[model samples]
Target: MTTSSTQQQTSDAFGYKWARRDSYESPAVRDASRAWLLSRYCGGDAAVLDAWLAGGPKTILDAGCGAGFSALLLFGERLRDHDYVGVDISSAVEVAAQRFAEAEIPARFMRADIATVDLPPASVDLLFSEGVLHHTDNPATTLRHLAGLLRDGGRALFYVYAKKSVVREFTDDHIRQQLMPLSDAEAWAALEPLTKLGIALGALEGTIDVPEDIPLLGIPKGSYPLQRFFYWHVCKAFYRADFSVDEMNHINFDWFRPANCHRQTPEEVRAWCTAAGLEVETLRVEEAGMTVVARRVSAGATYV
Candidate 1:
């Protein structure tokens, strides 16, 4: 949608900016939150992370790390040897650092815009980014920079929003355009209609079944993750959608984000990878987004 603000900051798809907020995250919200945390380095998609992490003994850079969720999940209890550096433009950097301290993990966080974050060339073994690049000033340029940070034979795991889901599309558009820019109080007021609708629809109790007509692409069937999906759309999308200390501060930062890119097609991503000189290893579609693992190699270079 069209946003009119003195300053527009980069935002995740649908402007669902992730940060610390006091609003107690609902159960479904918490599950979604945990899922996102699990999606960082080894992300929720283990296949992509595992493949990229094949040949190891290297450190990882959690590019666009929002809350250190992914970093902790990836190198948490099982694999704690690999060092991790988490970076985000938001002040969550401090929160993330604290989380690492509590977890006793060799992790650190910095508040730096990934696009302009000046990292040494070819210094990292793996670059893990999820739902971050698209929200940057220039997504393609961001990807190029992230790729540059990878050492030779190093792999990158990226999870970008894919333009294949209808429900998700509706949810984001409704929030960004019809009801964004409202103060949390005002936004919460505006959300009454949605919450009511969800309750009514859910109250249907399978009375009026949704006809098997237009397929809701990407979104799985059978009440799969329905509670979380509803909360995200009805409440979280409108109010502060995070659960952490000093949340309003984080919410305000998210409110000012300008650049908000979104889902792309496989053809689009594949073309970009080829043009960037990265070899695509795996490409898959998920309910909410897509996963791509590509390796940046020199001309005439190959890998096993």
Candidate 2:
């Protein structure tokens, strides 16, 4: 298939998947619930977010902002003060709108591909695209496009999956190919075994000592926490005990359903930042792969 055609297919698939965000994320039903308030700050350190927002009222763009979950985390109750724009390529934008409205957050959601989305040049103060670019047909090019949206000296953060062990990589590819032909319901049904396996492995609370290095796959021989190793090598990284069965299924579907999920090496991610003239503030290889925070070198310079 052509590149544009592939991009459209990926977007449509995400559109379908994210419309069921409540199934996965369980967005708050009412304004008073603890889930409602806590969901706003889920999965991130508040102090780090505060540091990012310290500059005050800047134009923030959440590229691939799925269901406004990140927006809730980023803006919280102070939404009226920040200029936040969320662009996505799915019906999830509508879901995001509803969720934000429920929270009384004055955030806007637009349905558009982040790669081709048009905005004023050098207009964004902070651009956040997590777990989004790697699903695009061309991650490097899409990343450059995202970088172009930032004002020179503006900050941006991204998360992409890290390259995995060769065994795991092939297993993921095989499972994804099998799942691709199945309907969402069928695919979820098919993934139950894997999820159960993950649950079983998580129960084995012990450490794994990798006595020999697998140089071919770049897996260093070391003492790895068993839970982390199980997640890193088996079960599609679905070891979170707190997630409900449906939520775990959602994670499984997210991994196997996407048509274009790319994993990159640390060197490649660093190279992209360098090519875009973004000075790296931090680059961490966490469970999600690589999380990078970078700033454009100049205050208003174009990235072309």
Best-performing candidate as measured by TM-score: 2
For 199-252, candidate 2 gives per-residue lDDT tens digits of 777778779998999888657788987867766665374756666666676777
- Per-residue error (Å), model 2, residue 248: 1.0
Extract clashing residue pairs from model 2. Answer: 152-298, 162-289
lDDT of each: 0.59, 0.75
Misplaced by over 4 Å in model 1 are 1-56, 164-171, 184-196, 199-204, 207-259
CA lDDT, candidate 2, residue 84: 81
74, model 2: CA deviation in Å? 3.8
Write down the TM-score of every candidate.
0.69, 0.85
The weakest ten consecutive residues by lDDT in model 1 span 6-15
Ten residues in a row with the worst lDDT in model 2?
Answer: 28-37
Write the residue-wise lDDT of candidate 1 on 70-143 in tens digits: 55655455336666778887656666677677777777566777776777988988788866766766677778
Error of 2 at 8 (Å): 2.7
Best by lDDT: 2
